[model samples]
Target: MIPLRQLPRLLRIAGVLARHRVDELLPASRRPRSLAWLRALMPAPGADLLVLPRGERLALALTALGPIFVKFGQILSTRRDLLPADVADALTQLQDRVAPFPAAQARAAIERAFGATIEARYASFDDAPLASASIAQVHAATLADGREVVVKVLRPDIHARIDADVALLRALAGVVERTHPSADKIRPQAIVDEIETTLVNELDLQREGANASLLRRNFAGSDDLYVPEVVWSHTSAGVLTLERVRGIPVDDLAALDAAGIDRVALAEKGVRLFYTQVFRDNFFHADAHAGNIWVDATRPADPRFIALDFGIMGSLPERDQYWLAENFLALFNQDYARIAELHVRAGWMPADARLDELEAAVRTVCEPYFTRPLSEISLAEVVVKLFEVARRHDLTLQPQLILLQKTLLNIEGVGRLLHPRIDIWATAKPVLERIWRRRSGPRAVLRTLRRRVPEWLAAAPDMPQLVHGWLSRANAGEMELRVASDDLKEIERRLRHGQRVAIWLSAGVSLAVATACVALLAPAGAPPGARWVAWLLGAAAVGAFALAARRS
Candidate 1:
């Protein structure tokens, strides 16, 4: 059941959709049948609004709905393969351009966060916002020590707003899961959980500051990329202060050209930087949209990327990191079979899935791209196509990978915008190969053993006792083994049958021995009937042995 407090907000959302005529965008088959009656309650859209393209109207409707929906639209914009081109293009405007809250409210938020007057915190503070996005807005400020910085303040009541909207989204996701035919494949609920986690992390400015600091440290002396330093003294949960830096937005081709920047070098550098972050450093900027990435114009010939907005950062499990690097290498080598094997081994695909079929599917998706010139090929598009094929073969989506996919799309887009003829695979392959060699080399293995051997030695003394305890538990019938594979289950069944046969055979042998002793060692005082009884028992033991042998 819907919460009473959420009904008004739900109605408001529906009314906004109706007011912009966004419902027309959804096909009749895909529309929620239960909410069909809500259309009657909606006010009719203006004729002028109706004349606009459905994609634009939908984007406008999402903007009207609030930051959460706008953010959703921004993510949707990246999946050009999944969405209509026109709609995707329209939704791209939502990235980092949400309407800002009032400056007075922003000031109040800052004051509340610091428990001090705005004048007391900084030497000089700008009331005007430098940039505004869904969760926060930034203002330029000067520190007491004469350093220029940017102060990021969270929006007022953002937590309550996001919580309420997230709850509503979860409810709707449940409805979709129940009603939609492809819900299992699409995984609406999992997507919501991923988005919720990202938003929750983004809400904490201190966490963002930490992420920035770590990234800065990782690339401390690198010429290819620069991360702004976080001002720890001025940062809090609700606000963050960072050393202010200026650069041309990566997407601004005209400005870059005016600054005499080498677009090709810049594009290649971006690709290499992405590989380094993911494969070597294992930490990456998850949100690498054009607005957040900028080009330093100081050295035109050797361009560098300046990263901002560290709210959404991503890393992978060590296993995933290795597998993904290998997967990329396999793709580069056109080793579809290896790719298929890697997917299964990495638990991305079901173990029982046909390797030949998966390999063929992957080839079908990737072969055409190879036929095209490297300049025209899109790494992001290839990954998306592979994902589509994997989905057909029951791919298990990893929630952690969602950010990586989005980041890849954003990075590729930025690269293409900078240099139309950039060869992403060529630029990334060498970087990946170097990292892979370092990680998988003999030195790496020795290093791992060196780190782990001491721990193993410390735990070695308990090995016998632990093994004894486990064996005792098994003998006591207190242990249960669960197997997921059909082959393993079949093997277990056969072993159980063999165990029962062995038990019966042992009983039979014991009975036969006892019967022989009774027959062979009978005293003269014993009745003659004892020998006959022993003979009968021997016959019964022989029968039991025959039954056990036949069953085996």
Candidate 2:
């Protein structure tokens, strides 16, 4: 259920869409059957969208919905393969080109962020925004020391708006999960939670600045990619300032061509850079859309990529990184068995899962892709297919893996757009091979052992003391041991049964020997008590032997 306070925001969202005649743009199948009555609730019942195309109406409605929806459009624009060309083309307006707020508002925001006049902070601050989005607008400026930088300021009251939207999303997630039959499999709430974390992180300019600084340091001296330097002194929770870079926007093919850039090489470089970030460095800029990327065509022969918008970066745990790299290598080798084994090894699939069945499933998903030439294969499509297969096999879906898949899709779109024939697998195989070789080498084994030597040395002094304590306790008949497992318990029961039977047999044999010795060595005139004792011993031996035989 929607909260009373958030209902207004939800109504505003619906109103904007209805005002733009958004329902007219949707295909019949895309609209939910339950929401068929939405048309009756629209405010502008007579609104006509004859002047705007369906795609344009969508873009307008998204813009009116607010910044978050605009960002969604921007991301959707990257997947041209999935969207209609008209809609995808229209969404480009949202990427670093969303309609800016008033110049006065921008100025007010800057002054509010720094608590001083613009001139006092920047050598020259522009009132007009360089780019604007739902959350913030950026202004290009010159620093006091003649360094060019871009100053980003958060949108006014963005926090409250985001909070309201997030609450609405949560409410919607709950409603869908509870009411929809397939919701358990989809896990809409989990997805919403992930989105909330991402959006919340993006709201903090200080965090974004830190992200920029760390990424800059990661590729500090590299020519393949460059991360702009952050101006730490001017950065704050609501404001971020970073060194401005000049380059041709990555999507501008004409500009790249005019500048003599080698598109194929640039495309290949993108693949290498992605692998390096994900596997080698284990850190990547999750949002690598064309809007956040540029090409330094000044060095056309040696093109370099310039990255911006460091609000969302991703990294995996060390184990996942290695497993993912191995998975990639296994793909290249067409090792379906290894891939199946890897799923179990990575704890993605249950240990008892039939490897042969998993292998066959993998082959079913992947074999068709190899029939096509490597240059013609789509990396994103294959990844999607594998995800479906994973779901079928009940594999444990790792959130980090999802993040990596998203990043890969973004990268693949950018790469294919730049060079249609560039083979992603061909470019990535050697890099993964190199990483695997280094990690699996004997030197790595030695290095790991060397690192543990100090730990072993520190514990060496206690070993003898531990040994002595165990021995002393054993001698005092106070030793104790405990282990828990059904298999071990059964073995323990059998061992105990065998030990009892052995004792019983030994006692019976000893008694029998004693009884015989007493009878054989006694004199003819021996007392009746001796004879009775012998008879008693013989009878006891017979009973003991019978008990031992029954047990055995």
Best by TM-score: 1
lDDT of 1 by residue, 427-481 (tens): 8889999989998898887677556644644664564466457556665667645
Q: Note the Cα lDDT for every prediction shown.
A: 0.82, 0.78
User: In model 2, which range of ten residues has the least summed lDDT?
Assistant: 74-83
Question: Which residue segments of model 2 deviate by more than 4 Å?
Answer: 12-34, 40-64, 72-97, 446-552
If scored against the real structure, what TM-score would every candidate get?
Answer: 0.80, 0.77
- Superposed model 1: Cα runs more than 4 Å off: 19-21, 33-56, 75-92, 460-552
Q: Write model 2 residue lDDT over 425-505, tens digit each, in one string.
A: 888889777866777787777567556644644664564466456556655657433449988888877875876677677
